[model samples]
Target chain A: MLALGVAFSYTAGWLAPSRLSAQRIVDALQQNAGWHPGYRRNHAKGVCVSGYFESNGAAAAYSVARVFAQGRTPVIGRLAIPGGNPAAPDDSSPVRSLALRFDLPGGEQWRTGMNNMPVFVVATPQAFYEQLLAARPDPATHKPDPARLAAFFAAHPETGPFLAWAKTTRPSASFATQSYYGLDAFYFIDAAGRKHPVRWRVAPETADHTDAPAGPPSKDDLTDDLDRRLAQGPLRWHLLVTLGAPEDPTNDATRVWPAERPTIDAGTLVIEHAQDQASGPCRDVNYDPTVLPHGIAISDDPLLAARASAYADSYRRRTGEEAHVPGSAPAADATKASQP
Target chain B: MNTHPAFHPLARVLHWTMAVLILAMLFIGVGMVSTVSSKHTWLLAIHKPLGIAILVLAIIRLGVRLRFRAPPLPADMPASMQWVAHASHWVLYALMFAMPLIGWAMLSAGGYPVTILHGWPLPPLVPAHGALFGWLRLAHGVLAYVFFLAILGHMGAALYHGLIRRDDVLPSMSFPRREPSPPQMSDAPATTQASAVGTALPEQPPEAQPAGDPASPGQGDAG
Candidate 1:
């Protein structure tokens, strides 16, 4: 029976205990190829399983960065027309909308999916209602009238920053292939757990390009790119997290965080698997700024404040209830407020 | 009158097992995030297999759902709510399957081995050092949070039906019935990103100190 136990354990990859034995496994896995029969890399350094080098989406066991901070997770995201128009071409618009959802660790969640625009076309819910209404195409023309956009522009001057990005940043059908913004005043903790407000952006390994397809692009381009890219290689993103002191105006997100401050190496991201954009993950996920990681709390951005309410409403609209996520354990919360 | 037969026996088994595993997974997730890298020696050893277990169980549960039909909703439930319930349940199912797969995919993208029980390393599903891990991680973080909200509503609704409304919803999914009307996938819903968002070991807040402003939007550090 004991012999059977050892054999079963061996077959199951369970190695016997002993500092040396474990080390030997680590050493073997770490070997040029690795130590244990197949697992650890007995590399030059030995069986060092550093998160930085060898991540498994379980970074939560170490630090909080929603992406890596938890156990294995599944996700889905949706791209759609921002206006009431369900058929809006992906191209005719400057801003794109992404609805995202994550199933994470410890039953705690922070869900909020937003748009390409840092700030919304309007701040107040009332104003947003108006924007949604005005975004309608002219009855006479039955097409999206420039007048509607002009009026929305005239109504919400705060839309200036995002509008600037829209005007400056070229829109591509391959948006999933483009950079995505947290677009709010987001806080990120460094290795030491200190907080900094950042406007996070994901720079795609595959740069956005529309040179190939002629005519303004089509909304389907983003989908085309996603499929094409998935077939081709892995999708990579660089997580550039910005830092700012509390009350810093740049943290407002109405204005950009100055180019001067340095964004710590919070992490890198790679996505090998992807689901259909029209899937439930994208539709149900909420990217509200209010759902930021600890150490990375919300800034006093008005956009974020509106987002707090709007996103919850959005989730309810889709899911039929107020989101009551059993929030992840607070990160250094007492350590922050009490320490000061 | 078979008043409590909405969930199948197989569903019940998968559901309870998943519940225990999921809750344990969530707690383990919390513990994992709170720990620092240098200090997290043992907690991590558990995270891998547990995650692998979730993945396997989710696959099995999905297969069962596909192979066996889920008992229909109570006859009197609202059509829209029924649709919503179906949609939510499937979304949860999709997430369950994807999260663990993403973990494995991430490792494959990073060129790392995702061994089951530290045994035979699964062949790389994708290539090594592929950029997908980064985007997959982002997508994973984004969706995990949303699922958290979904679970909250699910639990609250079950409690509402079970308590306030005094409906049989709770018992149907709860115990002592032996009716096997358990949630097919079990309520093993947890958040990977939630803990990451909350329990990040505080880093030294970089004092507005400028270091060449690569921090500008669109201008990332070029390696």
Candidate 2:
């Protein structure tokens, strides 16, 4: 009894809270790129959009999730550039994001925050955190210290391909024309409990894909462009899920599967309207990448958990500041106001 | 019940306040983990500061508990029951301190800020280390279940004393009444003399005796 008592006490003493580390990443982001109140720590500049995801039932065999059962699932989404400053010029960052929350049947929901990049910049959460630290602006120069960035690049060779891609790729003329990739791999659990590792991307259906003109960009270039497009008609994107082979890396998001892999056109995403984030339906949403329905599950990709944690922390900080800010409440008004 | 001595006023206040805070913390903790909705953000914001509040209260509560003597258990109560009561009380106190401290440390290891209010963040308790964070996260999850079980057991025991046993144990820590004190009979001597002669004498039932009289030093530390 005494031995058991001691063991019990020791075990009890070890209990701590989970996901406590997310705040540090947010803090690092704030340190790197100044804090913006009532805005996401990253991807602070964005436009909110409401739409519907019409599933074609092709993905039903891969997952038992009801969202894939050939139906229209209402979606609220946000499109944004990768930056901490909400007022940052759209041309400043090469990476763009498309985050969606699908309101499924039976009140179930699936949320995913995807980016335009084909793969993530880092392999692990630690590396990502370190990258944030390395990219922190020097106090004297107001720019990332070249020495620190060089040191980081030398240490992580895997970042070379992403850096090369970012350097060469031109920004898309509009958010509606860019393909958004879910860099992290996930498991689609079938009805038989079989797990199929897959990566997904939303390909734009618009035929007028073009690069932005070479000139100084407006601060609201992306949002304004999206607004103009929405004024004409609803924008559409096809959801494509790529099946991975057994040898494909599931844990490292930096690695990509073979281009020859089979791809499934799971559904079509129709974004009907766009509005300013402050008064938009998607303003209050947290598109955590891990918020999967019953048929979908997160894989061993470390970035997924890191993204979920950081998104949660970012969500908490912004919402806490929401009450102090005006014109940032009640999505209903914004929905009606943005309707054409 | 009127004869039973009430718990120290400060202890009672702390007990009740901590009770409410703890219950709220448990619910908030559960909600924060289960959902990734927009509501999760505010839940977490409330959780961080609330945890720190519980930590601060637990320290003060522990100090208050140690400084004042608790009322003695009824002499007729079984020895096993007395031991269980004392042991469980200590366990509750242990958990009250452990949960918040571990949470703070886990956050520190994870390199996260331990913000209490909106803008004020506490200093980290440990240096950032990923391995330490993983271990601490597991420990925190396991302990949460244990803490929940302990809370249920404590509530069950409290109800048993209040309803089933109908003993003075429950009332001892309850809100005090405004009744005048009994005569200055030096109730300490009477208690010592009765226990010395043995509780088996059957002349008076244990409930009939003055429960609040200055208890013997050893028995006064029942919890």
- The candidate scoring highest on DockQ is 2
**Per-residue lDDT tens digits of candidate 1, residues B67-185?**
55443333344546544555566566666777777767765664344545322456666764323544554555456556555555565555555555443345444442443344522
Predicted candidate 2 versus true structure: per-residue lDDT over A242-300, tens digit per residue: 99999999988788899999999999999999888888877767788766677888888
True contacts kept of 2: 0.00
List, residue by residue over A1-340, the lDDT tens digit for candidate 1. Answer: 2443354344223453331222222222121121111111101110000011112433333246555552334433444434323334555555655433343333233444445655544443345445544544444555445777688778778668767776775555554555556666655554577655566554556665553457656656655666676678666655455555555564344566567766544345455555642332232234444543333455555455444433322332222211222321123331121200
Model 2 segments more than 4 A misplaced: A1-20, A324-340, B1-223
TM-score of chain B of each: 0.69, 0.77
Cα miss at B1, model 1 (Å)?
51
Error at A149, model 1, angstroms: 4.1
Model 2 lDDT per residue over B56-168, tens place: 99888666655665666555456576556556666676678888888898777654556574223577788755446545655665677677666666666666755665444
Report the error of model 1 at residue B123, Å: 33
- Model 1: residues with Cα > 4 Å off, grouped in runs: A1-75, A79-81, A97-104, A112-130, A143-152, A189-194, A209-212, A215-219, A245-247, A277-280, A320-340, B1-223
